[model samples]
Target chain A: MARNPIRDEIAIVGLGSTGFYRDSGGRSAKALACDASIRAIRDAGFEPGDIDGIVGAAEPGGPNPNEMSAALGLPQVTHFSSPMPVAVFALVDAMNAIFSGSCSTVLLYFAYTRLPWNSRSAAEDPFRRHHTLGVMPAPESVNAAAAYAAWASRYIHEYDARREDFGRVALNARAGAARNPLAVMKTPLSMEGYLQARMIREPLCLLDMDIPVDGADAFVLTRTECAREKTRNPVVVHAATTGLVGTNDEDQLPSLRRHGQHVVVESLRAKSDLWLEDMDIFFPYDGFSIITLGWIENFGWCPPGGAGRFLEEHWDPEAGCVMIDGRIPLNPHGGSLSEGATRGSGHIREAVMQLRGDAGERQVAGARNALIGCGGFFFNSQGAILRRL
Target chain B: MSEDVDDAALIERFPYVRIDHDSKHFYRGWLDERLLFNRCDACERFHHPPKPVCPSCWCASLTPTEVSGRGVIHLAMFLHQGPPAPGVDYAMAAHPVVAVELEEQEGLRFTSTVIGCPREAIRIGLPVELGWVERFGAPFPVFRPVEGS
Candidate 1:
């Protein structure tokens, strides 16, 4: 029988993670990444020397992309970019490389550590070195926060969203964390405990957010036919895309115009020909809990005001949430809230794990169709949908 | 002697003109606290973070409009890390960062803070009134959730 060309195409054959850690045990970012990559290559039943193409998510204070290429001792790299939402970008880059015949096998890697030795004290640091090290200074300056606060104040006035909703998101994640061994905040969170947490920014409390975590994860991508030769089962890359509308300039859509239209959701729906209901698992980026609500609404799971209700209804354990439907699991690996942020790589690694059917105890049964979304700064966003062929 | 005095004074000052992108000739000189925004006649849209040009129409035909000083709480988060300099006490109670939706503007959203109350009381969807504090030669806008509303 002649095979369907698209059905049996590019596939992810191997995956590895250094687990999620609050600290890296004193290893440099490259060292941590190397550890994960080596394991991934071996997991794919290939040797370290077998990889021809390498890609990575950009990390602050980590090895540069060129340096990683030199360290890996690859003959040449077909493609690379440190785009925000790194994991998806890395996968997209690898796909392009394979299609263009640049390299058949690719290694994608990421790592970070938050141990005190690995962590820098914010107060003692002069000139805020870590903040300045990234592509741009951290956007948490008083001016920027003030700008966001102004917007938050307006959102309160218009949409009638309440603090309880934000609290529910954090509490739910915290509660979910208690069940997962990988979560940093594994302690059970009470409403009173959440309310008592010191306020950082008005209307936003410490418990209402995720802390930066240190860890590493990697994956190997190759042509589906070649991948089938290596692994028992291969997850196919059904589709991948990234979107950026306006430049970083403040004037493009400004605050008013940008709020109503969600470009990321619109773009993904157009490209995939799948509705929110079609996805078996959702890995929407939760850089901020409020952002998750935005994703839920934007993805058309519910209308604008429907996110709070959706969470309240689906979060019940005894009732057996209908949203997941035994197939449509939402972040069973605890997501960024529980798994720690490997930058955007965390979400990608989770998707890969589910597709490979190796997500272990947290695995969703027969999760054939999966969706992942990543958003950056003020409007840069991307998404990819994958399937097990 | 008079010539020397005149030169000294002139060196310390220079003539300058403030350019306006929108026809909203609104300016504050730090006397009274007044909240204002710009409305575009072409698109019939209002803008916060008050810019000279209408964001929607990109036209200079913007007119100054006074706001009701009331808004709805949209979304809120307490960011512990990555705050910029000029740090006051660690807790920013709706002072530096908060998200708000205006009561008057249908879809306008602005990120600011609410002040004049304990930080713990700020709730979502709370009705808030605009407040201001002048510092470093500008009036910074903050919000205070309306009491007993």
Candidate 2:
């Protein structure tokens, strides 16, 4: 809480992303990153040379900051890094660079191709490998689904939550995506369909998982004053923080197993002036339905293990929940479940769009503030509070 | 499912032990038909999946202690499908993966499969007992429903 100087000091002035798809075979991850960067810079009313800093969300085999800078033909990039795989970590880095007077404008982006099922990238997860006791990991352990399934199963046990409860989260995501043109899964997801879907892991149906789509999303962050000059709707960074507290050192897994939202959000709440009620939209990272549930509890939106009842009573797949629309919308951009997994950028961009009033069909009316949650599966937690200025 | 190669190849690809400095003793416990966890000599806290240093007290001194291997299923999932990967072809339809909170420790849990019971019968909080199964020529820890409990 000491010296919270970065609050409202930085703003997102521009945003751009490649069209989401199941498999964008023609483009490499670098190409997607470059394209998104170019469009985002242009959207911010600047060219490649105008960007003095760059931060990239870590992607497997994706372009680093230097590669992206070279590809974008940027004349100078004083601050450049792509060290972390977590998306929110990268965004926070960009905000820090601007806050520290290290750079004026920062380009932040994440890009990746949906590797083929037979591809090695599927087993490239460092967490699974590390947790596997240095032995060959079970195929289930190799995929993120296993980790989520572990969490979901634990959630179900502790809360007596049902698959139907988690199903609602997926149902709402698909419903939101049906309205989003950039979303990959457009078809309606019903409870019946969700229940009938093939189980990827016990407690986790295929619908409960995210589609690894090939795409890239970019955002332009600058000083609040400069952002206002660049664009009429500059989304102010209300609060941003990242840390590994209560997470394992080796695997970076949450120390509490199925809990991390409190650790991340509590730190964020300490730094921000807003409460759960002040936000217009909630994009608690939907890497898993149970994760979103954790965020719901950890943020005091509902009590711990009460997310099922809260969601069942609050969320409606048809008209969109009054909780999401009237009170606060959750993942209004269809989230990672339906929206292609642009890491957390898709969530961040959707929050950005909602705050800017540019979210055509999914816009939260008179939106002012948005809360974005990132990184729980990796045990690390990152959060951001954005407000429309 | 076994067409690609043999059981050995499949098990090697999806190993149960990484055989690190901290975990070698833990896997050795499996070979001895015992479920072992790292017990911090300083704080007396139990660490699952074997860590070199105690997570609670940050003490490097630890010992692998055997447990009764009786646990309650903290959570359970049935993997009926899998991702498309050459190494992942070993997943059988309707495989039950359970996170069992060992009775020895309050929150100590590990990812293991539940066998000897119908996959549908596996539920969270179900009492389970560790049962060793030969996987890749080594004793791999698996769980089964503890009857009458």
DockQ of 2: 0.35
Q: Could you give candidate 1's per-residue lDDT for residues A139-248 as a string of tens digits?
A: 22224223333344444545677776666667666654555565666666666777788765555566545566756788888898887776657888776666655422
- Stretches of candidate 1 off by over 4 Å are A1-8, A113-157, A175-182, A245-261, A319-327, B1-87, B91-94, B98-149
TM-score for the A-chain in each candidate structure = 0.84, 0.90
Query: In candidate 2, what are the lDDT values of residues A63-162, reduced to their tens digit?
Result: 7888888888889988998857567888888999998989999999888666534234533643223222223355434235467777677677767788
DockQ of each: 0.18, 0.35
lDDT string for model 2 (B1-149, tens) is 22343445443533643455666666656656677788989999888667778888999999888888888887667766653433234355466677777787676776677878875678877899988877656666788999886
